[model samples]
Target: MRDVAKVFDRTGSTLGVMDDLQVALHTYDGCSRGCAGCVVDKHFKNNWRFRNIMTGPDMRIVGERVKEYFHWIQENLNTKSDGYFGTNGYKVDHYSYTFRFGNHSELPQDMLEEIAESCPSDFRVFSTAPSDEIHKFVDLRRTHPGNYFLEIIYDPVADRAQDIRDMVLDMRSNGILGYPEVLITQRLLQAYSPERFVEEALGPLGDIGTQLQLGRYTPSKTRGFRTTQVVSVDEEVRWMTAVAKGIVDRKYDIHPIPIGEYAVTFLDEYKEAGYEGPDGYIDVARLPEPEPFNIANVVKKTRDIFLSSIYVDHNLDLHVWSESMGQHVLDRNFGFEPLGNVRNRPIHEIVTEPNGVLERMLREVVRNLATHPKCSGCRYKSFCASHAIPLFRKWQEDDGEHCYGYLPVIREFQKDRPFLTNMIDGFKELGF
Candidate 1:
């Protein structure tokens, strides 16, 4: 029922780059899962006075906004002209969309069906539904066949871990995409007792056969009444490495997971600064390439801003990352003026307008990456150069709630390092 399609570029330009534009339409807002370490809860809600729990009827508006954007893509981006790939080129790839951004939100069944019917076969369907409704998504994929690829997140700490285990076991036994992606965070790791973690968490997948993947949880702040737990730098590396080692030593059927190499490569700047933890142990094993730590090797030519993908929030407001803070650049309200509206403007103009917010941001980002002193001398320039300025800008704007730490580039280096390392290795190019 599920399928995989190769994606080369989102802009459909003649350049043979491989960046994918993953547009996500948020079906709902406000998560009920209430994971202890969620950034939304820790930073957005507590500090910014950001309201959570926007759902139900609002999803219809999300669906409509996505439909409008999809319509625009079909009219403008998905063209029949072969010039997009040039005369000698054989394949052209369009930007793909997914209904995957928000957590603890449900989709209107009718809207899901409409999206399943409308998007290209390569469109991915990502969900984090509880175990009982997990099958509903699989069934949806079965009905749609090759139209979409299915990605489900099994949050081990989510109260339904047992149900998740049961469903994953069933899928693996029945050969249904094996086991879906399991997301284990420090929040989850610290939640369960060690004995329960081994018995309930790791025990179920003991026989899935080298098909599993160990994912590194992103660096984040866990909010507490009197203090905040900033899981950055050393902590992020340690936990991810521990998770990877745990998976490997258990003799599960997962791929190598690359946690070691990623940690090693991404921490180049830190190591250069002679930074070392109390134990002086580097969790991940290092890789040899990127010898001088070149940025060119990580990112390709086409400039990309952070959170470059398009997202339509629950309120039908189109959003993009206006700054490095990952704050929503809404097409409508929320006190901030948006770049452009999906409801009124064409897709190309919104993204490519010479003086648009995204364009200006991208320009400054590129300029800063080229000129910044630390970036000019740093080894991982390619990986962080594109958005380093905005990340710093966002940190200043938001007071470092979601951004992590006060040190200029230290937190930025640690925040998404593990994931970026895996992505860079996976794509053999820089990714954000």
Candidate 2:
């Protein structure tokens, strides 16, 4: 029952930081967290097999498909018709996605009490599990307080430092709320020492409120045949600018998170079942060499080009996300299938289907980027001609290679978020 709490809207320059509609609910079907940079074992290696476990008739078919898709999104997309977010005046409202909505694994306490009692929004429960499977979900913070959080990952080349100091002292002794994602590889930026990893793994969680984040370690691929580990957006922007300079010489007051651009597929049923991946010709010779396109990475690459996200999977299929063209997450299917079936139509007429197909592939990606030519000399070409130039021409027609690896970490994340480059140059003067 994925995208159960389904909602929409996520177009250009994140329409001023996503103004409404965004639910995202998921129960779990696989993912036992065999994390070796798990992008679902780099796209289900050897045809899937790293699951967690859930039984009881898989929690009664995930509580009858999440209460029948949240009763068909409160009886069909909660009102206001003829989309364009209701005649372009926008104000939709749906919220609820405060942290994990599945996929980083570890929730099974009866699937977190059937997503905190048959979902209805208000989420937050990401984990990595340790302190004894997170002290059996600490009675979900006395049954869900400030929505329950954990987020901990800190894999300095495969986690340890005493299992991240006993899961941050069993999440500050169960009071919970203890964020810290930190991944940055290349063997943690050439064997990161950062003063014994900030003096014995982030100085014994001093803050008690941890917020670090800092991510990166993408590179996945696996379907039919198998094996694909290409790399080159100039060596993942020099290993994400040497792990954002080891989280700034251990100054450690982090919050980077931007790692976008990764499309290199090459299928043909993994080449008529011969299979032998790797080597993606320098991601097709650095796709027209662009990067360094300022205006602060247009809302993290326009949230992977105009595809705001929706995601409901476990056979209730509805998807809508659209980024990650490669390293396969089913290439973020926005439409080529399942624009319906929330257990039989009516998710607002399968998202306003006026000859739909994701509205003619988002209006032919603005008439193929207003008639391309390497999108008129890049410079964030009109926000990638209204959203990632038709996802880089379908990642060069699925021969794949579009990983711009966030252009060498957007000049060190516009030097500590310089007001997010004036709100991405004020949405490129309203032409987003």
Residues 291-374 of candidate 1: C-alpha lDDT, one tens digit per residue = 463334223222333333566544445556322222233233222345565555554557667677665555555565566554
Q: How well is each residue in 344-410 modelled by candidate 2, as lDDT tens digits?
A: 5544456556876555555555555545554444444544432343444443332223334254444
Candidate 2, TM-score vs. the true structure?
Answer: 0.31
By summed lDDT, the worst window of 10 consecutive residues in model 1 runs over 1-10
Q: Each prediction's Cα lDDT score?
A: 0.42, 0.42
Clashes of each: 7, 3
Using TM-score as the measure, the top candidate is: 1
Q: TM-score per candidate, in order?
A: 0.56, 0.31
